[model samples]
Target: MANTSYTRSEELKEILSGQETQLQQKMDEAKDMASFLVELVDTLEVTMSNRSAKGDKEKPLRYCTHIMEQLDALGWDRVTLVDQDLSRVQIELCDASQRKHLITARFPPAYPTIPLTIAPLEVPECEDDQLASQRGLSVGGLSLKQGLALEAAIRQAEGQLEIFREFWDVMQDFDERTWVIDPEKPTRADKMRRCALGNHCSIQVTVQPLSPRSMPDTKLFGPTASIAPMRTKLYQNAGLWDVKKLPRENLEVLLELEGGFPSPVSTNKDDINVGCGICYSFRFEGQVPDQLCSHAKCQQPFHRVCLYETITTSAPKT
Candidate 1:
């Protein structure tokens, strides 16, 4: 009986030791799980802190309010349109000469921290080079960079407007005083003017914005015979070009026309000089017939395309 009791006690001790080993393993697993959870919580806290820092840096609401304040200070008359999301705004500015110009400003979410983009709505064809050099911004006189205030940007644009005032003044004179054959509607950005000189002849001139008072690059469009005398006069009287006079007056002196250029209102519609003889239309696809019959008696104008098609159809098949 004594031996049996001792064996039972040893068995009990073995069972208890096995249970203690299992319990130790469970405790170790719980400790590992708790450590992993703590690490995960730390990572989450860092991510949230980074998100908070980024949100504070952006401050989109503050940017919108600042833009609104700036626009209000500029006056409501200058504000043409504003986007619902406050991403874009258009403003109308007048030069010293009272000529109006429209400019657009686009803002990013992080505006004022980053440079906003500004550009003129109607930039001129000749000013493309200047625009490219200025990074597509019409404010050539100002070097816009990050942190530039909206008011400063606007002031710079106004200064640029004044710089081009004389150039626009010259263009305005041409539009008002001369019968511009091309560009039915002239804009402030237009540097070239093709004016009618009667007898199916027109003079195309490119004026330099920087030197509006100087002689422009001129080209005559007409039949060979009609243009020959004008070309000769242009070469002979080239020295007579006056920087003091306007472009129209200088062209008149150079061309030496007996009568001034044909007036838009005074011109007769039935006159053969106006439209293409073949199409009987003044403009074909936004262009007038530049090709003219060489014969002085005919002097009939023909669209280059129309003339080509007629000649091709008339040719005999091989």
Candidate 2:
């Protein structure tokens, strides 16, 4: 009886060992840090800029929160937020010439488990200012994936890695002599349109989430003699964005963009002012209101979203 019990125990140990081996193999097959990020960004439609009147400071449950704690321990501060959301954060660095830049990273809806997007902040509208233009555009063009790898290595498996410092260091090290361009990278101009005919037109695209990864990718051909065909083809490419109508070259589209914002559509009914009555700030950033309250006498122009939100939030809690 004693011999039989010992043999059974040994067999159970062997079974556990086999299970461990199988688990290790599965982990080995798992996607690496970079591939995971590409998948995550593609899944989330990670754009450089996303502004909602509502806010982005979403608090994650596990991974991103761990990273945030690590960042706080490292003394890096949160990005100065308009809505005070912690969904995105940054670290500021200055070169020898005192040129300052901000390294910003944003946590997607599913973060930590999915790699965070680490990139420099961009102020495209303010490029005329020497410092402002360069602040978010890094000199080296080092990929965000590489920075994430560096962050992991620096942590040395002690705790969760922090990406902000790694990003800052990489940009500081970039110089003309050290920078080398890789031809295979997706260029800034052609990111949305991948040219197949070799003219940076006749673009191809694939949606990461909505379509199956195994499915054949689709292409959106650029303009020809008349834009009518291109507009018609856009119907097939409706997955490209939320809108169905291709932007018209006619005055309607032009006027919409030009007059996108008029003023504060809704504001503190009491504050009679020339600027946005909601924020009550004189500085408008050259942006006007896209919407106006319908009453002719109460013609308050407002940012479509700002006014909508102001009115929505101000409504009585029923």
Candidate 3:
């Protein structure tokens, strides 16, 4: 009886091992399918972008339809895409549990060299649910299926970004010595002017509860983007601030900029006293609103309107 019981136990262990092997095989197949789908979608995106750049407007619609059919066949929904100057898409997928999985892809106008960015959506508290199940995965084991799905999205965005970057580089090149030719010499205090194509268009990527990986393995085609966990509103009333003192980080900067008192003068700079320093209150069609010395450096307040009028009126317009 003792011998029989030992043999039965050994047999049970073997059966369990066999089942695990089967399940692992199934998982591997699923992963491969996911990866393939992502690649298909990514390829379509690149082809579409190339067509659009060549002024083939009708091709994009056809490409999109093909992508939609592919996604539909795979049972995906809750995807929203806003294709504008900077091609951005917000993708949300849910499992049977209605657990949200989101990915945001940004394709800037830089064309070819600059890459697209794909970031995961961050749910408020549940960060781990979005990651693949690590229950059976061994050390260094990544879910190829999950990673592939994400890779496809990233590849698509990155490809578009590459296209944009390539075009932008060509436009920036005036000569080897002076690629960025500034017609007017910038003043020392002036904010660095960005390239018209680069600044006016940028791919903004936002993802939530992103997995803490060093970086995605795929080569990015465009400028990289970052998304931080939403921080709690750390606001303090400027009225409570010690104007005579400056906090190292200027914690009260926002409140100072917002203004403690809602003086109609605070809202509109146009009608304020002629020499008053706070002038955001008075805005004409073409005039910039005045800003106060909110920072500790020179807390000398100035009206946005009055300051502009004082400086500009002092200098005759050419």
Candidate 2 global TM-score? 0.25
lDDT of 3 by residue, 36-125 (tens): 446434644665476558654342343345444534653445556545433556766543333334456554333222344555333222
Worst 10 residues of 2 by lDDT: 174-183
Sort by lDDT, top down from the best: 1, 2, 3
Give one digit per residue, the lDDT tens place, for model 2 in 141-170. Answer: 222343363244223211212212332222
Candidate 1 residues 38-79, lDDT tens each?
Answer: 643464456446645665444355567778888888888888
Worst 10 residues of 1 by lDDT: 1-10
Instruction: Report the poorest 10 consecutive residues by lDDT, candidate 3.
Output: 213-222
Record all residue pairs in model 1 with backbone atoms less than 3 Å apart, i.e. clashing.
none
TM-scores for all predictions? 0.71, 0.25, 0.23
- Model 3 spans > 4 angstroms off: 1-66, 73-77, 82-300, 303-305, 311-318
Runs off by more than 4 Å, candidate 1: 1-60, 120-147, 265-274, 312-318
Candidate with the larger lDDT of 1 and 3: 1
